[model samples]
Target: RIDAETRRILLLELQVRPGIAALQSEQLVAKAFKTKVNMLRSLGSRVVMTVLEEVLPAAAREAFRKATSSSGAAGAGRGVRPAASTAAPEPMPVAPEEHALAARPPPAAAPPNAPQPAAAPHAE
Candidate 1:
């Protein structure tokens, strides 16, 4: 256990100056903001959460929303999963001649004697 703690401490020590020369400005900002977050966490104030939300990407925000929904921690931002069909689909157009045929339900399985597509001129 002491060895494991020492390794963890060394890992954090190595990352102490993270993003000092990152190509992107966001990487540097994220690292700096993390230090402030640690301070806020230690002080036990949740006000920083609002600030944290501002830094998260849209994809991460969406994943967090989904996770919150599944974890039953939902409230104001309840993570209700979207319904399969929230909007009714528009009905497809059917040819006048095929209206009667379309009105009938389709067969569950094709009979071996069913007409092949090659036998129908309008199959296409």
Candidate 2:
């Protein structure tokens, strides 16, 4: 009886996990669509990121970045100024030959000892 219950539970779990994942995916897609529409509405027309970067002045861009980065950290909640820490900002190392960050390899496959899905019971 316990074995049958365990199999039933596993089957239900397999079905439910996929359904939950699908619902979450749909919600994310809807959010992305809404955000894109809002961006288009605010911009007055569709504009690529590169075009905006080229058009906007460097000072304006830097000010925008600073405002965005600082707002959540310092002005979150009641808009109190956050205390500054003494730690120095870490420097990002770039590849001298490529002038860009190093590329990461794809994720490794599951280990040999990984648990695999149980086989479906025969309908007979």
Candidate 3:
């Protein structure tokens, strides 16, 4: 049997828990519960997140949820789009000859007509 104390406790608990809506409800009990919840929600209780969206009519919020969930990257409830990521460009392919040349040391500058070492012949 439900008592005044039980109802009072449930109402107080509702402030911290929005899911306090009872699963087992008779017609009268449900009506009483809804009335109490509506009163509390109308006062913009911190427990009910709907207070932040009080400016929007209920239908508009539902529609936005559906629209964003299906096709848009729109963030949850904030109406913001996710940022796109940028990729680095692929490197150009290096030729074998060019690579060898680039790896070689720079030739030293010599005085005019300075004697140079003779090139060694490759063995067959």
lDDT of 2 by residue, 5-115 (tens): 544554454444555676775455455556655665555322433455788898876776576457674544332235568999899876675543345556799989999
Best by lDDT: 3
TM-scores, each model vs. reference: 0.24, 0.22, 0.22
Model 3 residue 35 CA deviation (Å) reads 72
lDDT of each: 0.58, 0.57, 0.61
Q: In order, how many clashes per candidate?
A: 0, 0, 0
lDDT of 1: 0.58
Off by over 4 Å in 1: 1-10, 14-49, 73-124
Candidate 3 TM-score over all chains jointly: 0.22
Candidate 3, poorest ten consecutive residues by summed lDDT: 75-84
TM-score for candidate 1, please give it.
Answer: 0.24
User: Between 1 and 3, whose TM-score is larger?
Assistant: 1
Better lDDT candidate (1, 3): 3
